[model samples]
Target: METAARTDEEWQEILRSVRRVHFVGIGGSGMSPLAEILHSRGYRLTGSDVNPSDNVDRMTGLGIPVSMRQAADNVGDAELVVYTSAVNPQNPELEEARRRGIPLIERGKLLGLISRHYSNAVGVAGTHGKTTTTSMISQILLEAGQDPTIFIGGRLPLINANGRAGSSDTFICEACEFQDHYLSMTPAVSVILNVDADHLDYFGTLENVVASFHAFAGLASRAVIVNHDDANARRAAEGIPPERLIWYGTGAGLVWSARGCRLEDGSCGAYDLYHNGEFFTSVKLGVPGAHNISNSMAAAAAAHLCGADARQIADGLRDFRGAGRRFEFLGTFGGVTVADDYAHHPTEITATLAAAKGMG
Candidate 1:
């Protein structure tokens, strides 16, 4: 029987046993953040990805060896091997690890194990806005002097990278639902921005998706922040206590709500933020988009629950322009506005297009 670490102390023992760690499919968005965090912690890290990306180069520049080709030689005396769900079963590195009886852990389990070290672990979960909302929360914590360790799915401009290793015990990261990855996390504060039908290929049905979100909410130890406008989100958060739940939306009534939109000139979205029927403050987002208003409200609600003042929430969001490749403006060509984005999912694409329409 193979034993796995169940607690932070147990995981620490596992870490001490290994001198170097190898990651398969390391260039991936999900795997790269963990690699960066581990690298910053004085671990000898080696990785291999089937495809090459700018992130691969970034990791190499950080003194972590990365190989574009996957082979058995890449494992190279690694004590522990971590592989993403995307890695092929026939991959030579994986086969070598199995043959050598090296302990192999999946990506989600590694993330959950790592999160246990933080006193305040905020897992931002949603079908659509996990990256955006995670970035917003990171910015808020930064402004409030929390010095949080951030691991976002997309590149955040505020952090100047997709992830950062902070000295503080506050860890903020995106909890993805695909393959029920969020199930591994036990967060101090869990923010459910919204729940929509997605990743059907893995989840099989919409009911399973709702159940997964509910499970994720139940794992929150401190507070559960959700979008009141989304019914799926409300149902999913039913596992948590009523008093522990903090609702944020553009709805008529909620714990945190944004009202009085000022999107006339596409400069910035100005709104009066309300908390429990009382005016909190006037907030102006540096980023443009009506969806961003809701995202900001969610971030502010989580930040406030975590002891951030109104000023920190406002200023943090004000400084957050946007994430890299998230509706990023490229130079125009021949009187045509050119922009680049990583919105591949249909729902994300729809939201991105809607935001683009609101710009003019």
Candidate 2:
């Protein structure tokens, strides 16, 4: 299992040992975020993509070298190489890395270390809403004056920055459940918004997938906030040392839940929060979708558990509109509607389409 925070010694060792590192798929969403974070940390970074992309351009602007094509020579001067799962073992660049005996790290491990550095490392794991939920949480933290170093799977509009290196002890991150990637982080608090079988290519069955969420929930030393409404989420988080379990539902007795939920102007989500059955406060989200109301509850609960005041939570939620590629309106071709989202899996597809249903 992954721990959210790493010791100073561990980080120092990584810094001292890894002088130069290269990324195999630089344009990838996950890879680009980590590359930028490492570049900010002052590691000599070089990466390659199959073609030019906004990610490649952004990396170059950060003083890191990027290439449109992958060459064996790209790994020449680098002492270590990192590659995503998409890169087959037989790939030319990966072959070179092995031949050179350069320490090869999987994409998951690289993201794990970055997650460990944050004082508040949150892994939002579920079959759906990981990206949107992470972005919503990030927006709330941003509004509350948390200079959090946040990394979301998609682009968030509020920050106008994909990843920010903040001075505060708070660090907000999106922990991916694909291939059980969330297993790498040790979060102070872990949020299980909901759970269902996903990434069929990785986990053979839904049972195995639920077990993974259970394992992740157990990693939360402080608390595990779960969607009480989601039987699967509750079941997956069953044995979470009673005290470590915090439940949230739709206006139930859970610690956090949405009350009076509604969409505003068909562009944003609005809802009132009730804490343990009492009218807590109201929030006007800058993003669309009714699902975000529940997503915001989970984030607010996690933030509150991490010591963020209610005002901070409200401010962060208000300021955060949405992330990039998450139902992002490209341009309307007539009234049919054209939007882009970073939902690659069937589960993601279902959730997004469901959100879209309210439109008609």
RMSD (Å) per prediction: 2.4, 3.6
Residue-level lDDT of model 2, residues 1-360, one tens digit each, is: 112244535644755688798999987877887887777777898998897877777788888888778888888698767788888777788888778766677778777766767766777776777777777777777666667777777777775556666666666677778877878787878888887777767888888888989999988767888988888898898878887888887846677778777877664678888887777778888667777777888888877765677777888888775678888877777678777887777767776787677655
* lDDT leader: 1
Instruction: Write one digit per residue (lDDT tens) for candidate 1, span 146-181.
Output: 878888888887656788788888889899998888
lDDT of 1 at 210: 91
Residue 186 alpha-carbon offset, candidate 2, angstroms: 1.4
Per-prediction TM-score to the true structure, in the order listed: 0.92, 0.89
The stretch of ten residues in a row with the least summed lDDT in candidate 1 is: 1-10
TM-score, cand. 2 vs. native: 0.89
lDDT of 1 at 224: 90
User: Local distance difference test, per candidate?
Assistant: 0.83, 0.76
